[model samples]
Target: MAKAFASAGDLTEKKISFTEVGEGLYAFTAEGDPNSGVIIGDDSVMIVEAQATPRLANKVIECVRSVTDKPISHVVLTHYHAVRVLGASAFGANQIIMSDAARSMVMERGQEDWDSEFQRFPRLFEGHESIPGLTYPTTTFSDSMTVFLGSRRVDIKQIGRAHTAGDSVVWVPDQQTMFTGDIVEYHSACYCGDGHYEEWGATLDAVKSYDPQSIAPGRGDALVGREMVDAAIANTRDFVDSTYNAVKPVAARGGSLKDAWDAVREACDPKFADYAIYEHCLPFNVARAYDEARGIAHPRIWTAQLDLDMWEALQG
Candidate 1:
């Protein structure tokens, strides 16, 4: 397993990095952590995903301030993961936008997910006490919604599900750029704990359909150029396929989760040895893949106990 999680004990507090992908589009990324995007318009700015807490979100706000002082009018949630959505309040956006499916996930598992994520990733929740409560969207849509930043247009759509049931992407056609939340990752690991491996490839394909010149993924460095974009999507797809295919046969034979995990580890550790968080995410990834291979359509909710139990069972 790669040593991505080995540095978990050394993680510093949230810090933001702003990379300009276009004239007004900036990709705000943290250190191998959840990312938020900024789109500056003539009169206002729109933030993509909110961080995990107000403290974290404020860092993104600070970066935005460096470029322009436009009021943050809208905060768009790419999905309903607690680490991504709970920080909405810090932005003080007049309108919090999300897909209809995302709103449903918030209502269904928001609290449980919030608890589960906090327990698994303590560092990301720097000031957990500062969080007011669960975040709910003020505006939601089923398929697509368009918001204009004065003359600039930002399109939000629930293209398809991959990482979770409510995964969405922010596409700026004019800039030929896309902000894909967990739908794509570069260098960093793809957290498949709540992912649908079968549909993940298709989701990547959908994102590629836009032919984005640049893409800010959920984590890692922002991708530039069509070649880089395709490579990133392919890397994410291969990661999912390798894990699922490696574990499926073992699962079909009624092998134990441990046995399946071992098989997947041996198969993937060679090819994906350099990817970030490979070790940190392998156990959870294997568990979900094993379950899916056995016909479990929906990913089982992860709790703290489940996390520790799986870690010990597979990594012990």
Candidate 2:
């Protein structure tokens, strides 16, 4: 292969930051790694996006402990990705929630995703053995649901599809803060392997319509003020648009996947070369974009072997 497969060569530990985006609301970020959010209500706390393993989840728990002593009552997963859902067991929350579509995806390809991600990024899966198994949600909602943590009212809604088929966002009406899973990213590559490129813009629009004052994105730093929030959303949109638009033309002309990869690099590398996980996500993003442009609706499930084969083919 021309270079390391995905993030296998990335072994250095990242700097973790727990930033406050709103009153009693925090965003747990690790440089450019996947981020998690904390919503402390009057009587209890609600966690968004569990880390990859129990050990990693402990890091977020420690941050939660520093601010408040409320027991975690519920865990709301924004999506079904292994990196985000596998750590649910550590929270010991009374209820775990996900979108109805996310649960179905878990039943279909959760294990395969776990294996594929474990192989691509060894560092994120530290203490992988501790993961009880595929994380399943105890409850799910179709369109939107409201959970009141004591007096705090939290609104969870599936705005549209961007990062995944069942992507959802958490909104705190009082503070005008929203926790957008992978739908919006800041200074990090959006992993579009299972994304819907055509529908992502509408999803972004749905999120923007709220006029959120603060946002805890799926990856990158926490956006505090309205200026930062708007900037991050715009940046995320550009990243997604550049990737799909670059590949759509190639696929329309019956070009090979390699051709699409080169086109995307030419378009995106100049602007996003320094973005976190850019190289790791490029191949998969290009492959998915090409498939979408060719009329493939659902993303093909990725396995460990398929990951290696795709990397080798793209390198050649």
Candidate 3:
């Protein structure tokens, strides 16, 4: 367990980039940090993902104010992760939107998740005291819902289950821009602690069906072209498939979590060893893969203790 949970060691600030992917669609990417998407309509603006805390979210608000003084009318929660949803209060938006399943997860494990994630990635939760509690959605949709900012339309759809059971993405038909939460990460390790692997693959295919011209992925840089979009999808699929493939057989053989860890290292090290968060994410990813491979339908809720126990058991 020598440095099993060394997430706090990564405290360096990333270089933030605010790039306009479409006419009024923008992506605020901070190296490999969590990303936020912006859409400025004729009347108001909608922020795709809220940062970890209200204080951190203000950084995004500052960037938003630099371009347009429009009131942030909507705050969209792409999923139920605390890092992504807990900062909703900062926007002071009229509506907070998320999938119904996301809301359920929040009701069930939001507090535990907040503590678990904060423990796992302290750097990401720098301003922990600023978070006001779990962010409850003002609006929840079952499958898909569309909100209009004047004549511009923003479609929010539950693109099946991948990263979580409530995985959702915001799509702009006119700009052909899609803001996928963690459903599609580019060159970043997709955290599968609470993921649904089989359903996640179909969800990625659902993302491909849109053929989006621009994609503001959950992490990493924004994908602004067809080729890059395709690459992001492919990279995400590969990460997901490789993780499950590596762990499934070991799990079927009644192997230990450490055994699954070794299989994952052998399978994913050559291809994605250098990816951001690979070291931090490997244990949790294989834990879930092991569960799913053994016919576990739903992801077991992960508490702070579970996170540490799993890491110590697998990390050597």
Candidate 4:
């Protein structure tokens, strides 16, 4: 794992990496930051997951410009994470799509999540003032929706509850490629702070059933071969399972949240020590797991103050 900020004055903007995973499908990833996907059809394009702000999204748009001049007609949000969906306005997309549950989450905790993520990752939110407001889906679905880009079929499905209650995957059956939001991460830390561990693992199983030849994960390099795709999914599952299970016993014993955090660290640090943001995400992950273990089905609202409080309580 590379240190996100190794020195005090390291202020270089992160470089975005885009890889063509299929004929017209591209995966846009940054240095363990939020990722976006692109599917170009004959007449139009569909983008998946916007960055934190318009300034950040333009970098992705520039990448798309390199490929085709077709208008980006649809922006599909895999879930309602502030870092992933707030940049929708920048694209000037005609239809912003999302799962019904994701739209609800946005209405429920969008403001709180926006504030919380801004605090956690200020670098990702460049030109923050340009963010008009919380992004809402112009089009939403209960289970799945299929859109055609000319003759190409792009199927967006709400697979299962993993990263959030409304986690979704964009499957391009023609190319046999799937863009898994945060449900799958490649060589990057899984941000399980707002995740449902048990359901997340099961969701990975559901994703595996697709047998995709290539996969674009939420972060890191795109998986090309079938073996690499499976490996990425498996690694994501292992990370979630270890984080949740490590904290579960302590949480069940009626131990303090701090104790549960320590238990998770002891169990996970050795295995996931090299992943990006491992240290930063642990406390929040433990806190969420603790709450879940205690029967909290929904993740609690995470405010900016709450983020610092938990960080200090667990890491200070």
Candidates sorted on TM-score, descending: 2, 3, 4, 1
What's the C-alpha lDDT at position 217 in model 2? 99
TM-score of 3: 0.98
Candidate number with greatest TM-score: 2
Query: For residues 1-316, what per-residue lDDT tens digits would candidate 3 score against the true structure?
Result: 3664837678888888898999989999997889999999999999999989887788898888889999999999989998898888989999999999999999999999998989987888887887888899999999999999999999999979999999899999999999999999989999999999988889999999998999999999989999999999999999999999999889888998789989999999999988888888888899899999999988999999888888778775
Pairs with steric clashes in candidate 2: none
**For this target, which candidate reaches the highest lDDT against the unseen true structure?**
2
TM-score of each: 0.95, 0.99, 0.98, 0.96
Query: What are the lDDT figures for the candidates, one per model?
Result: 0.87, 0.95, 0.91, 0.88
Order of candidates by lDDT, top first?
2, 3, 4, 1
- For candidate 1, the lDDT comes to 0.87
Candidate 4, superposed: residue stretches over 4 Å from native: 1-11
lDDT of 4: 0.88
Instruction: Give RMSD to native, each candidate.
Output: 2.1, 0.8, 1.1, 2.5
Give the per-residue Cα lDDT of candidate 1 at 275.
76
Which is better, 1 or 3, measured by TM-score? 3
